[model samples]
Target: MPTIHLRRRLVELDAQILEQKRVLLDLQQTRIAVERELRETATYPILTLPVEVTIEIFHRLPLEVGDKMGIRRNTAPISLTAVCRIWRGIALSTPTLWSTMNISFDDIPSTVIAKPGLVESFINQWLGRSGECPLSLTFSLPQLEINSLYDQVDFSIRRLRPIIRQYAHRVRYIELDFKEDTRISELELHSSPFPLLQVANVCCDFHIETRVFSNAPLLHSLHLGGEEGVIVTRFHLPWQQLTTFEGFIDNLDLFIVAPNLIDVKCYWSGRESTLGVITHSRITSFTIIRDCDILQYLTFPSLQHLDVYPLVTYDFFESFLKRSCPPLISLGADAAGQGFAQWHKALVHVAATLENIKISYVPHEVMTSLLSLEERPWLSPPWRTLNLLPNLKTLHLSPVYGPVDQFYELVRFLYARSDKLRSFQLEWFTTPFLDAWIGAGAPGAHEKADTITGHFSRLQTAGMDIYVGTPNRNYAAKTHDAADV
Candidate 1:
């Protein structure tokens, strides 16, 4: 009986083992099927399209991306040949794609031009590829190492001069950057003339003595920058089409005149005459860097915006407002905690038509004086009484030192009077007055701060925009002794 029972158990175990083997076989077959399907899908050949269709696809790509594909470099054509025979043919045939070229001779490889014939071949290939289409060229020449690269510069320029002069009428923009003084002077003398050049951006250390602008009849924009005391004097150059001009000059009296000038920006050499020339121009927008007493005498008839640093005195402030009051929309003044009486008087004058005001590095005493002047009738309605411009909408007060109560009082005064007030920006340096002011009040009180917060909150909520370090919260002392004084 025991033997028969053992035999039954052994047969059952054998049957279970056979069943396991069958299951493993089925899994292996399933995996093989999946693998075959994957290989078939992955190895499938991509459909071959017509050459015209492919070319159309390439043209549709962004110019920037095409440029990154190595089209801008002189070796790009040769590199594209390695991509594929079909790609090489397409790249070679696309003359318009190769028209825009950027040449840099600063780091030319020794292997590239070890032989004279190779160098000439490389230059001819790049210039000849453009073929009848107007080419855009960007030349970046380092002035410091021109002595070492002088031969390369001459060779490249000589090779490119024919192409540039031929396509000068079609060229739209030219950017020339020279770092070496000697090379810059040489380039200024021999620079190619562009008849249709509309934009010229030049940055060189040497003084620009060439008559390069004579050929640019349609030149509308000019940006020039270099060392101090660089005088630019040109006569008979077309300024009727010129709209924007920016440069650093010791004097503005050098130029004959820019009749169509709309925007004028200058970094003055602290000279009185330069300021005089800028003030006399009919520019709609004007910006001066430094403070000068002569600013009071100059007038911009069509001027709408003015920005200056190191605020001028109260007398000059009032004089300028009264003189150039019409068409003025925005004004920014930096006092740097120097003159309060002048700033107060200027603030009054600015309260008239100014829409935006930024006062940086103000003193605690000034804040106290401005805030405590509620008793004085003239200061009661600050903006309303003193040249209160009805059109004034935005006010930015920064770097104030005072209590929350003082700030609240100031806000109330401005909110009551400025019906068109849409924004009120505050940059707090040491106080939590902004947070408390926004947290303290009724819907109407919050509404005033909200108007400013809603419009300019995206720029900065705390003192992040302020140049003076991080802000901290401290409200233990109700009255600041230094501020009170």
Candidate 2:
């Protein structure tokens, strides 16, 4: 009878324990429901808006580094998705947000680069999320330090070729940077045209022999750089469609390739390069560095803006103006310790149309000579000619050495062109004279400041905006408008 009573008690206790455990679980579930409801209430503000509006807002956010869909974390798209279930749905569905990608091998892990198949898989996933949107892709090849990993890089390129070819039709902008001798044969391997490609920036240390981009009809802007620089490549680009080109050209004559270019920024290395006997009629703007007598060789009739640094000779420009007769409206030049003779001649030709003049580092002697009152019978024809820059409106001088003490001459120059001079700015306009005048901490510092202020006060009576920066660490000076009292 006692054994039977114990067994019954034990069974009852087991049943009671199971009942308590079930009740505790029910309470815990209720707490979770309440917590979730509170969270939804807190996010009600953003959740209240339409999903479309939120997607648009997300698109306007700044682009973040890393491939969140790949190995990278905390990317803009990833963060947006992590916010809430609603946000995650919207972000994953928005195709435009995933349209631009930089697939660079420069800083990626060696393990990933070695496994070309893995890279292709990640890229495939990323592009799949983009949902057929036009892509802007930048591929940066590894530098020389990874030369030993040639086999890995080759494998990686081979893997990426098929993936890139699949998406080539949808790519609008493409940039490639190659630092090593690893030839990018993939560009040539694909025969299909890059139908939508508009802009291309190619930087390679070696000459690319393949005419890979010859069929890209819509391509327009091209920026080429590297040590060996650009030579006629096997890849024939549609040069006729190119309106803007910036790069180092091995050959001076551009008419063969890019004749219709409207804007050209070129670095001509060959000192004697006369851009072959070709005339570029549509070129309106030119920025040349390390230029020689190339200007004399080329004719630019439609040019409106000219910026040159360190001309080979004044005669080169003079002859160019005589030949081209460009209606130049704006001109910028670096004298590079040269005399003002060349400038005077160039100004005489463009004075009728030139409105803006920005000269960097003109010698003090040149400034003094311009402001000098002495008459020189043997001076250049332009110097003898009064109102040299009759139509000049803005004059900006950026002197390499500070405190260009040509203030008096500069003011006089302004007065000469007071009829048309609207603004005059001097960068690094400091002076040891002013410091000495102030005596640093001398007793007459206030008086010195007043004296310099008075000099400028008189100049302000003229009708031009004058801006000068004091010799200080911070360039925080304001313009002293001459028109204002």
Candidate 3:
């Protein structure tokens, strides 16, 4: 072997090494381009968005916590973090997305991070991300056997007190739905006051002697859902500060005490034959359902909306009207006590201001009287003299079976008020037609029924929010023409 031959071999090897390095560089550049393209196109469209855009998108998700429906574990913000590193960063950074929570203690250890011992830490972490935003919290307990509920609810409350106290000042809305008939020994709240609490809904048959929610200065709305046994006075607070009161009220003291109260949704059905009268100047809306007889003792000067469902006494109802002399905007009542004629007479007091009328159930007498009313809902003196409700906006009727044939009369009645009308709901409008449609041996019955339904549809379009069907059906799409319905 010669020295010159060895030199030639070394040069060839060096050339081969240079070519391999060039190929390696080409492969590295190709890999970089492929990775970039894959991130842009192959990744989820949502994930590929700008971080801010992704955060905004995540905020729109309906994140309901402590749901037995599995929405939390599947679609919660936590789940977003589990998707990938990019989403995890995005979700963790968004504070408003974790500010609101609707928690139920029904399915224990299946909500949030979903373990027996982790819920507390999970909740702390969930809310910790909310930053300085106000919190909206709802804590509910499922119905269970008394023995079983005691230990479970006790444990939950023990765990919850500290968390609630931590965010008490930040609470804007808080609803505590405890198990039925839980004798709660009110804990000594040696913690911060709820200065930002605007709404507090406490639904429990409490046996506590101490007053709750007394420290909340900004509370405006309070819903106390206690049964007959739970005395209303037990959980007393600044009643005068509340503008809206719903659910239970044992006596008429609410009207007497709550001077600032504007909206009163009373579920009182006390059958006391007599009670003293009380006046509330600020009550604008009053809706009561199920056998109510409390109207006799109350009067409102500035009443705008009144909804009552009862076989009301004519004397009391008329007395209520004469005493209040309110500028009523809406009225929901049944033709009871002295029947339709008397009901109409009572309505004369506020007919000038009444725009919305809801009749509970129409019989032959009620239907006939309703048909007789001259086209208007107000007192238009030059327009034919007898105007019971001249400027009518909405008319809701739940007709009985016998008055099914009176649909045409209803049509005529609504046709006059169509100018100012917004809504006209006729529930069970197909009840009478069902017999005919189901073959009462009548020829062309089904076609006739179809035509009737079609007519109702056409009539619905005439009004801004007209619907003729059962309670659960959507007969018409509501147009915000007149007022909120």
On the 0 to 100 scale, the lDDT of residue 282 in model 2 is 93
150-263, model 3: which lDDT tens digit per residue? 444333555677788888989999887776655333333334488999998887665566466668889999887766533456656778899998887666667766799999
- lDDT of each candidate versus the true structure: 0.54, 0.67, 0.67
Task: Write the residue-wise lDDT of candidate 2 on 165-276 in tens digits.
Answer: 8888998988887765666665553476788999988876446565556667888998877654467444456777899998887675455677779989888766455445
Error of 1 at 116 (Å): 6.5
Q: Kindly give the stretch of ten consecutive residues in candidate 1 with the minimal lDDT sum.
A: 476-485
In candidate 3, list every pair of residues with a backbone clash.
376-389, 376-390, 377-389, 377-390, 377-391, 378-389, 378-390
Best of the two (1, 2) by lDDT:
2
lDDT of 3: 0.67
lDDT of 3 at 433: 46
What digit string (tens of lDDT, one per residue) describes model 1 on residues 1-485? 79999999999999999999999999999999998777555643221567687666555554432222123344445555566666678878877656556554445544453455555555457657667776565665544343564444233443445555555766776666555353343433235566667776666653545555566767888766565644665323455667777767665553336667777666666555633424444667766655544456566667677766665555665666566654667776665625434465555544545666555656666555654553255544442233355665665667665443464555444434334555654445543433442322222544433322221232223211312112443222122111100
Give the TM-score (vs. native) of candidate 3.
0.75
Tell me the number of clashing residue pairs for each predicted model. Answer: 4, 5, 7
Off by over 4 Å in 3: 1-36, 39-43, 48-52, 63-75, 110-118, 146-156, 181-185, 189-191, 269-275, 334-342, 375-386, 429-465, 469-485
- Residue 226 accuracy (lDDT) in model 1: 60
